[model samples]
Target chain A: MIAPGKLARLVATNALSNRRRLALHTFGLVVGIASFAFFLSLSMSVRSVFLEEIFPLDEVEVVAPRVGAADVDARDALNDDVVNEIRQHPDVKEAVPRMAMAFPASGAAMFMGQRMPFEAGGFADGVDPAYVADEDFADRFVDWEAEEHEREACGPPPERECGDHYYCDQRDNTCHKRVPIVVSRTLVELYNTQFAPSHGLPPIDEALEGMLASMLRLEIGLGETMFAAAMTGGESPPRQVEGMVVGISDKAMPIGVTVPIGYMERWNREFVGDEAAEVYSSIEVVLEGREAVAPFAGWVQDELDLSLADRQGERFATAIFIVTALFVMISLVIVTIAAINIAHSFFLQVSERKRELGVLRAIGGTRGDIRTLVLAEAALIGVIGGLLGVAAARVGAAAVDFAAHRWMPAFPFKPDSFFLFEWWIVAGGIACAVVFAVLGGLFPAGRAANMPPAQALSQD
Target chain B: MAGDPIIRLRDVEKSYGPASAPARVLRGVSLEVGSGEFVALMGESGSGKSTLLNIVGALDVADRGHVEVAGVRYGEAKERALARLRNVDIGFVFQAFNLIEHLTCLDNVCLPASFSRGKSPAEVQERGKEVLGRVGLADVAGRKPGTLSGGQKQRVAIARALFQRPRILLCDEPTGNLDSHTGGEVIEFFRELNERDGVTLVIVTHEQRISSAAERIVSIRDGVIEDESAGAPAAKEAAST
Candidate 1:
């Protein structure tokens, strides 16, 4: 049983004797570990962005036939009974009914009667104001009134549309001053990418002022006389009214807008009368968490016989994660090959130092001591390589993130980092490296330990 | 030289190859050396003089024998026990001066102590310097074996063998690789060490000149010591001077 001090000294002496070999071993290992860590961190970062920034994990949207089997209108679909049935689900956090206006918003108008038209049609769904105040993402929302003097804090006021009452944008999900119209984030993205270029219009640069002086239009389809005229393209629906744009939400809202439920109730009462307008178009079901979505959606389909749509847009998120995971596996395969090289290098080293080992054995050194000495050298390599790999991975990821932000500023859902190296990742990375190194040294150590003293002494 | 024999071997036999056609190296050989006597084992090439030394040092095991060193018998002792006995009771100086090239002279000297249980590296290192000084190579303690001359390397090897303070010193043609002048110096140094330190010495060599310095010169032929009368008391008195 050699003392640890003596063993360490032996390991150090032998390891340092072949400086060039040790350096080569460590360099290959460092690159392998760095690539592994880089891919692992990248997958985790993208997953985090998908969960935290892209969509709320606990919500789904539902719709059903309104009034009767022949009903083709959203104004009478998914009424109070359907909303109540969904609310009874144990996993459901809230089942807010989506209220629809009798007519869609056609254009935006100023006090001077200047009308700005949207390139395509749109719809306006009304939602509960109280829900937006509670569940909204505050940072992404642009508030117009708080710093009226600081209007330039965001951008031009041509897009700043605030009403005296609540209006849910369903774009950024942040609370703002009340209005009658809300726009979805999908609408904004579509307008910039597909809509702007073909229509010869400038793409939206900032979220706050992009849709200034614009009229989010919808094809009217309500009432007997107005519906007939709208069907014939003779005249627009009589139940039309323009409302200002208000708050933005993170939800993947449908085509047009989101107004307050209270405003919808009042407008429906005045135009269509209470008996015909008390019905809702659809309902939004917010669940406890992602785990509840499956069960709740199952109940809605089986028991209620209603269609539960995935408004969360998680399929794109899944595809992104799967691709990232594939890359991570490829990196690990590279690390595996590098570890094999490490094993080969150690075997060569042991073979090269047979004489030295034999001399030690001849001087009362045991087989265990020689084997331990070799393993200790391997562990030293792991520690140094693991540390270097971690630093290189971090710096490498940061460099890529910096480049991405510089070249593509408008990248959708971009996070602060493209590599999220949490504490566990660091710990796991080092542990993995050490395990690989130990595994690499095992066979060589066994070979050295099993050698006969005479054979070793006789070896070149 | 009044103490009982430090090393005793009775009918020790060693051979290689198949039992039916064995190439016997030692055939029922018996010898004994008393305390503090420098005995030389001499033979021609393949006479098994080195084999005898290896068996005495516990580096090689006799095929059929009763062997004892420092009052501990071999064959019954476990391999580990025998290794421990070799570490503590016998020291070997090989012809090649097998100093580990990577280690400093001091580390090479301290090597034996590191293999022994209950020995601290610090204590071993401290004692290594003392042994190096005794062998007249204290100034080269920090120098690597590669940097040392042939004579210096031999001295370092001698120092390493003496580092653990073993009772018996076994040299297998210790001056085989040195020049004539360095060989003479090393042989004289060995004689002085045996006389002054009172350590038992067994030296195997082919040269009669080297053997003349020892108290007894026993020749091996056909794996047996020459004769019992060759261990006469008169030889001890003549070489002690």
Candidate 2:
């Protein structure tokens, strides 16, 4: 046995002399540790986003129609009358009826008026504009209010202008008086070509702001007018109509053309017939209190005998989350294998320092003293590596964000948006690195303990 | 004037390997050294001279033996007790010097004392410095073992062995690694320590020239003692009278 102080000195001397080897071992450990940290941080961020942002809003109470369920008929779609009745229920605060009508042969034409097949769907709904004002709903659907502000500031066009009326569309992109219409850039281009000559509208190649100012002409019930006279086997109405463009919007409507419910009802009664207005395809409801939302939605589904589809969307999102987590776990496995390699390297180093260890033993070193020296070295490696790994991850995340924003502005690559960096992630990485290092040294330390002093002396 | 022997061995047998093929290194070997006597064990290689020395110093165990060093039975002693005996009752000096290469000469000397009970760092340092001064290595106390010559390292080993004030000193080919001149110097230091301190000394060697320094010389052949000679003309005269 050797004195601990002497043993420590010997160990330190050996370690220092063999610094290059130590550094190599440490480098391996650090890389493994850093990889683990980066992956774990990413996993945690993704999980948090899914749990706190997407899942909570979509999954907690909502239920969706099961896959392969029968297509809902017009009568079974919970008509406006039934929807109104459901809203009058004590639990229900407000219920908005939604109707989706498929236009089979009436496809969106190309800008050049050469008919390209475009199957379209019409979504009609009676919704309180105030429902759009709900903070939670606004936070989800319209993330920014600046677009709305810009539309408001621009006001209405001359032909459609009405005094003191803040006209707005469902997409929140366009605002004006008579009837504000929000259309996609694609739709605007098409409309410009179709009506430019007869209506004196601007060309499609003009800038968006200029096209909106000159080319946009609204046609009241264009589809309905064509459908009516044809029902009696008469000549169809002209393919175009004359109306003023009220305002241009920032985005296309998510579902269909967002006409006011009053306008839709008037069009149905005058041309498309009253029978078409009776049924709704969906409903957007708002409860007075968040606590009442679940019960009201459930009661509406049961009372109206309508299968809800919101829950299915939630299930799909959950599946996505599981897949993402699996990917993260696979990355962790790779990091763990790398860490094991680091441990193996450290073990080899310990074997190389056998003579030095024997000297310590002869001088009076306890087993614990040797173990501490090895462990200390390992811990140092882990800490250094962890810091480097974190820095690398941050750089990686920044690069991802930059490329995503540059290439796909519509879908910004926000690293922090899905995977946030947390303190525990860093701590976990360091702990893992250190633990790996110590574990790596265990076999070598044991071999050192069992070595005979005489043999060790003779070897040197 | 025969006093109780400080070290005693009776019918000690040491062998290596299993019973069937065991190589009996020490067979029925018995020897004793009186307190304060300087003894030398001389033998050719493979004669178990070093093995006997190791048993007496508690560095090894005999398979069948009743052996005692400083009143403790070596065969029946536990590991802790054996370590204590090795630390306090016996000190070892090897042919290779066996100094920790990273330590300064003073630290090498002070090592055993650091492991012993009731010794502070300051006291250990002071004692180590004193012994290094005695060994004429006081100037090189701050230098590492790699910096010292072979003679210096052996001197440091001797100083280390003596610093603990053990009851017995064991040396195994202490000057084997050094040149003839430096070997003579290290042997002179051993003679001085034994003569001045009255510490019992057991030295194993093959060189007949080094045997003259011992007070008594025991020669072994084939693991058995062949001859024993009394040391000094005065001790021989006294024995004759």
Candidate 3:
């Protein structure tokens, strides 16, 4: 039967009288919340990096064969006939046969001006020339002529079929004349310095754009060619070949020259020597649809009786493991310390307010009422702390991005690339703050509720 | 008009500590107070006067006894029911002026009433102000107890006791912390309340001066009543004198 107004006034008075202690308690909770938010954001960001960036490009489903388990002979591993059979399956939209070989090369001429160790290899993939005509894939790897036409409508009308070097306007459009080899921006910039005058190409500026116009020049052994001379034996027969640079792609290139499937088959027959050229160290296949890459890669491995190993997927897994362990342990320690601090603060608050609580009880407040009042105060603290933590995390994230861009310009922190402020992170942060605050308040609130009114009233 | 007793105790006993080493504060004590009677309980410290007063006020339960106040038996009553009885049937005025210091005089007076009964805040305020005015504290109604003088605090306590219109009022040394002049004024307020409102008043104190104000005085020692006497003014003219 207590009047609402009186009860509210009493609660308000008690809270105001001990404002300093309560504020201290709230501060401790804020720190805990901020730490929890940081850890939560970190965990989510790592997961997003794996799923969005690494997983899509690397293809997670193709399992590699266990090491040293009856290694298949190179001749029997992944033949062109087997690859063609996989492509015939209805679910398989596209299949590319690949061959890889690694050789030693000088890395000194790269753009960074320092000779870094380089592994040179030969890569060949047999693809349907029509696959490059896809509008979506073209956006990622090649700038479509249609898009260029759309951008400049009033400019010079596109020339009709400029031979094998460009797309010809015909009833059946195919990019078969000379497929553009995409190279990394790093390679393009480095090669521009060496061959700019001969090609009459524009000065390479942007890394991604530079990759578009660079070509590879290879020297095979007929007798005494540069590559043959550099080999262990002296005075080998020389063979020189020049490849037209059709298109430069922004994708990171494997440390090797990429040739068309037609060129690879011809070169393998002529120069690689029968026993060495027959075995491929590895192969990379890009499926038609991004979603189909995993299943198709799996199918290819099964058909060839060969295994696929994705270095990117393994790297991502290692990154997740290291990051999770480090952050989770740090967060656990921070939150535990904060919880203890909050508990001590609340204990002191209750002890100091014994008389106030006694007065409330004497004035007809039940034990339930006292407990509710204490819990409400704790909840309020948690809410404020949670908001502060979120704000701090956002500010910290911005500072981190800025610092990264300034310090590591080559690998600038890409804001859009990382997951930030995901829904689950926010929800979990708030829940953690509240739960911690409650845990801190439990013992103190219980003691306050059970205090003898007579003794409490008698206390000074 | 004479009526049934408002408070009754039969063989009430209260002990402290464990059974082997228990110290009995009250042993086989019995007493009664009629409706509208004003009685003063006089005893030295530790003579069980305060314990008896507490038992009568329903603030504590006797270890072995039948204690009844306003027709409710204390021993069998539930905790909530006892609280209800304390809230509505009995009003207490403590010796040390146990006014909630955070509250204004009017709010302090009205708290028990607000808790025990259903009344709008505005109504409670109006009633509280009226009671304060009755105790000659209308001007200080907004002042908290901390700022008020001792006598003023006691007046606020009395006002709070009267606001609920209880059947019995228990005062444990209501003027103990005040000066002689302030204490006399407080006693007068209590006397005025007893005479004008027909409220039963039970005062526990060792002060001889306060006994003069009561209609009857009972003295106790060693946990038992030693003597009982009518007040001087009533004794000579009464048949029981």
- lDDT by residue for model 3 (B1-241), tens: 2258999999999887899999898988888889988899999988988888878866556889899999888888766666677677778888877887767888788877645657777888899999899988999988889998888888888888778778788888888899999898888887887888888999998787789888789898888888888865356558554
TM-score of chain B of 3: 0.95
Mark the regions of model 3 whose C-alpha exceeds 4 Å error after superposition: A1-12, A55-58, A61-68, A74-338, A341-351, A381-413, A416-419, A423-427, B1-3, B102-117, B120-144, B158-165, B231-241
lDDT of 2 by residue, A198-229 (tens): 55544554344434423443433334334445
- The window of 10 residues in a row where model 3 chain B has the poorest summed lDDT is B232-241
Model 1 chain A poorest ten-residue lDDT run: A147-156
A-chain TM-score per prediction?
A: 0.71, 0.55, 0.63
lDDT of each: 0.71, 0.60, 0.63
Question: Residue by residue across A38-132, what tens digits does model 3's lDDT show?
Answer: 76676667666654544544332223354423664444455555556655765554545444432222221222232223333333222223444
Order of candidates by TM-score, top first? 1, 3, 2
Clashing pairs in 1: A66-A77, A108-A215, A123-A256, A165-A178, A171-A249, A172-A248, A172-A249, A173-A248, A173-A249, A173-A250
lDDT of 1 by residue, B57-119 (tens): 766678898999888788787666666766777788888888888789998898887777666
Second chain alone, TM-score for each candidate: 0.92, 0.94, 0.95
How do the residues A17-63 of candidate 1 rate in per-residue lDDT, one tens digit apiece?
77788788777668877887888898788778776656656777887
Question: Evaluated with TM-score, which candidate comes out highest?
Answer: 1
Q: Which candidate leads the pack in DockQ? A: 1
TM-score list, all predictions: 0.76, 0.63, 0.70
Q: After superposing candidate 2, which stretches have Cα over 4 Å from the reference? A: A1-13, A45-355, A366-410, A416-421, B1-10, B31-37, B56-58, B66-90, B102-134, B138-142, B156-168, B195-200, B226-228, B233-241
Error of 3 at A408 (Å): 5.9
